[model samples]
Target: MGTPEVSRSPTKSPLTVSTSLTETVDGFHEFKIRSYSLTKGLGVGKFVASETFNVGDYTWAIYFYPDGKSPEDNSSYVSLFIALASEGADVRALFELTLVDQSGNGKHKVHSHFGRALESGPYTLKYRGSMW
Candidate 1:
């Protein structure tokens, strides 16, 4: 009969780890809607999208729902959204939507992540995600 021998190795004092860095790359695109009256007839839940633009290596677009995105609204109000138009997952981004003033009064209405007083991390948009 024969017996087997066993050996053990000592643990290393320092463990090695690796990490990656990402510097934010910024880009912008502006879309304007002309003939607002013509869009209202497009119907509820229907939207017109802007041309795709690239930022941080991803494609994005703006969607305008002239008759509101929800069918339940009965076309009471208009809606707008920013969407990730390309194939991607867990994409992080910030968004700004503004309604420009046609009049000379300079009273444009703005909805923006940039205007917030508190510091915030970018939003995580999953594959084919849209933000209102």
Candidate 2:
């Protein structure tokens, strides 16, 4: 008689995603938009300041939406509030609003700042937004 074969189960590993900045609008000054894995440090934590700008002119706004359907679908959205940095070395925290779906396959919008500054140098800013 033949011996019975043994069975084994496959192991699972952690998921790591790589995100990039899709767009940066250069209006009054320069604003940058960046995306990264929520598990990674890029999504949250202290923001390393780069340059200083006129506080009066330092105003920013962001708009976000899910990938599929519109408001009728009861998707998710986010809004960001930005301000000028008091110092070049100032560090800030970027907020990440959670969307209904864990997957970021939905469409989102970010309207604020400009691409000029982002294009000029390497810097990070504070971001505050929401999702539903």
Looking at model 1, which ten-residue stretch has the lowest summed lDDT? Answer: 112-121
Candidate 1 TM-score to native: 0.73
lDDT of 2 at 117: 32
Clashes of each: 0, 10
What is the lDDT for 70 in model 2? 45
For residue 72, what is the lDDT in candidate 1?
Answer: 86
Model 2 RMSD in Å is 21.9
Number of the top candidate by TM-score?
1
- Estimate TM-scores for all models: 0.73, 0.21
Candidate 2, superposed: residue stretches over 4 Å from native: 1-27, 32-40, 55-81, 84-108, 111-132
Give a tens-digit lDDT track for model 1, residues 54-93. 8887888888998999988789878878888778556877
Residue-wise lDDT of candidate 2 within 1-132, one digit each (tens)? 899998979978989999897443334433333442332232222232223434333433323222222444332322333443333333232323222332556754433232233234533553322111
Q: lDDT scores for all predictions?
A: 0.79, 0.35
